[model samples]
Target: MNIVVIDYGSGNLRSAAKAFAHAADEAGMAAEVLVSADPARILAADRLVLPGQGAFADCRAGLDGADGLAEALTEAVTTRGTPFFGICVGMQLLATSGFEHRVTPGLDWIGGRVEALAPSDPALKIPHMGWNALDFEPGRHPVLAGVEPGAHVYFVHSYAMTVDDPAHLLATADYGGRVTAIVGRDNLIGTQFHPEKSQAVGQRLIAGFLRWRP
Candidate 1:
């Protein structure tokens, strides 16, 4: 199977590829992972994985100049019905717009704003990092089947998705208040947390994505 990870000059591409490679190996599936900025390559992908780091607004800007990448991605996922998996700031880009810096608009596939997780507890940190449990909401799909409600997944982000629709949210993590950790709407799946850094639970999540079919 072919999985294309979009390299938009935003984050570390190899790490995401390594994680997918490991998951595919464990799942006994022969998979080829490619990190390409070419829009044609991205459009032809069976599965599209968008992994990102750095500022949300900046990432959006980079994608905007990616020579039809933004349009291709939208068509690939929406029209051609290709499964999309997004990570970290990549997940936030799936929303309508983000308020990280100067209110940048996203792909608008899901309606939400990327906001900082509120810190009610004085002892809590701002950017929720390290290992945290994923609390599965309800109505589990194949992409999240074996992953239990309270499974720990690695995360490192300052902004979290404030999704409008409850049906889009698959799981949440307790940063301070319920911060969106995972979102799955139709063929699109997005994770605010980094599955690459998230060990076994993360691997299983990736495995599920490979096996998941709509």
Candidate 2:
């Protein structure tokens, strides 16, 4: 299987690539990991992983600036039903639009909007960095097969997603309030946390993603 990690110059792609490779190995799936921005490669991919950091608008710009990359992603995931995984800002891109610096449009895979996190508690910092426990129903989604509820996942972001439909929310993390931690609808899934940085739990999630047929 060809696992293409969409690379539109968003942060370091190597770690995410390595994690996916290791996950594929652990899952016993024969997969070729490629970090690229080529639309042809995207069309040929068995699965797609999008990783991003920094501002939501900037990430959107990077993806849009790429020649046919955005269109290719839309076709592969929306039209062809390719399994997709988005991380961090990549996950935010799944929203309808983001209000980071300005109202920037997103991939709209999930009907929602991305906005800054305003923790009700005064103690919680802006960037909810480090690890947090995931509140999810076990075995509800294939990509979260072996992951138990309350598994700690690493997160480093200030913006959070608001899903229009509650059904799309697979999991959440309490940061002064309930923050969208995991979301999915059909063949698409995303994580606001950095699974690559979540250690054992993260690897398990990634491996599950590799084995996921959806």
Candidate 3:
């Protein structure tokens, strides 16, 4: 199977690529993990991963900047229904819109809005950095397979996705309040935290994604 990590010039591409490679190796899955913006390669992918960093507007712009890349991705993921994964700002881009830096439009794959994290406790800091425990919903998504509740994942974001439908929320974390950690529907999955940086939990998540059928 061919897995493509969409490089839109905004993410920690090397680390993500390494993690996927490691996961595929450990799982003994015959998969080739590639990092590219080439439309043909993206269209030929069996699975697609979109990883992003920096601001919403900047990431969106970088994704759109590539020639026919966005269209190719839409065709691969939306039309063909290839399994999709989004990480960090990549996950935020799945929302309908993001309120970071003057409200930018996103891929709108998931029905949600990305807004600044408003912690109930004033002592909690913004960006929500460091590791946090995940409170995953029971038996809803395959991506959480073998992943236990209270599993710690690394997060570093100032904003979080507020999903329109409760069913779309796969996992959450406590950051002075309930923070969206994971979201998934059908073949699409997203993580607000960096699974690559979450140690064993992150590696397991990567393996799960690699083996996930949908």
Candidate 4:
């Protein structure tokens, strides 16, 4: 399988690439993972991973700035049905729009909006950093195959995706209230947290993603 990790100038590309590589090795899959901004390479990928580490609008701009890269991604994932994995701000981009700094349009693959986390409690931090437990939905999708409920995962974001459709939400975490942890619809999946930095749990998720057919 040819896995492409998009380098849109706003992601921890090296860590993500290394994590995916380790997962591919552990899964014993014949996979070639590449970190590239080239549109042709992205279009040729069997599976696509988009990682982002900044503001929603900034990430969107970075993606759109790449000549034909956004269009290629849309064609490959939406038209060609290539499996897609979006992390952090990459996941936020899956929303219809975001409300950070302004109302910015997103990829709209998922019916949702990215909004700032309004914790019920005043003491909770803005960036919901550190580790938290996952509450997987019953009969979760294949991308979370071996992942268990209550499994700890690392997170580092202030805003979260508020999905319009409840079924699209695969897992959630508690941060003064419920926060979207994982989401999926058909061939696309996303995580609000940094799975690459989530240690063993992250590795298992990565491995599951590599073996996932849909």
Q: After superposition, how far is residue 186 of candidate 4 from its true place, in Å?
A: 0.8
TM-score of candidate 1 versus the correct structure, residues matched by position: 0.96
RMSD of each: 1.2, 0.7, 0.8, 0.8
lDDT for each candidate structure: 0.88, 0.94, 0.90, 0.93
Positional deviation of 157 in candidate 1, in angstroms? 1.0
Of candidates 3 and 1, the better by TM-score: 3
By lDDT, the best candidate is 2
- lDDT tens readout by residue for model 4, 1-214: 8999998898599899999999888888888889998989988998899999989999999999988899999999999999999999999999999999999999999999999999999999999999999998645888787788899999999999999999899999999999999988999999999999999999999998888887
lDDT of 2 by residue, 1-214 (tens): 8999999989958899999999888878899999999999999999999999999999999999999999999999999999999999999999999999899999888999999999999999989998899998877788888899998999999999999999999999999999999999988999999999999999999998888887
Task: State in Å the error of residue 23, model 3.
Answer: 0.5
lDDT of 1 by residue, 22-52 (tens): 8999999999999988878877888899998
lDDT tens per residue, model 3, 1-214: 8989998898699898888888888888888989999999999998898888899999999999999999999999999989999999999999999999788999998999999999999999987999999997657577788789998899999999999999899999999999999998888999999988988899889888878886
Error of 4 at 117 (Å): 0.6
| Stretches of candidate 3 exceeding 4 Å from the true structure | none
- Assess the local accuracy of residue 82 in candidate 3 as a C-alpha lDDT between 0 and 100: 92
Off by over 4 Å in 2: none
Q: RMSD of model 3, in Å?
A: 0.8
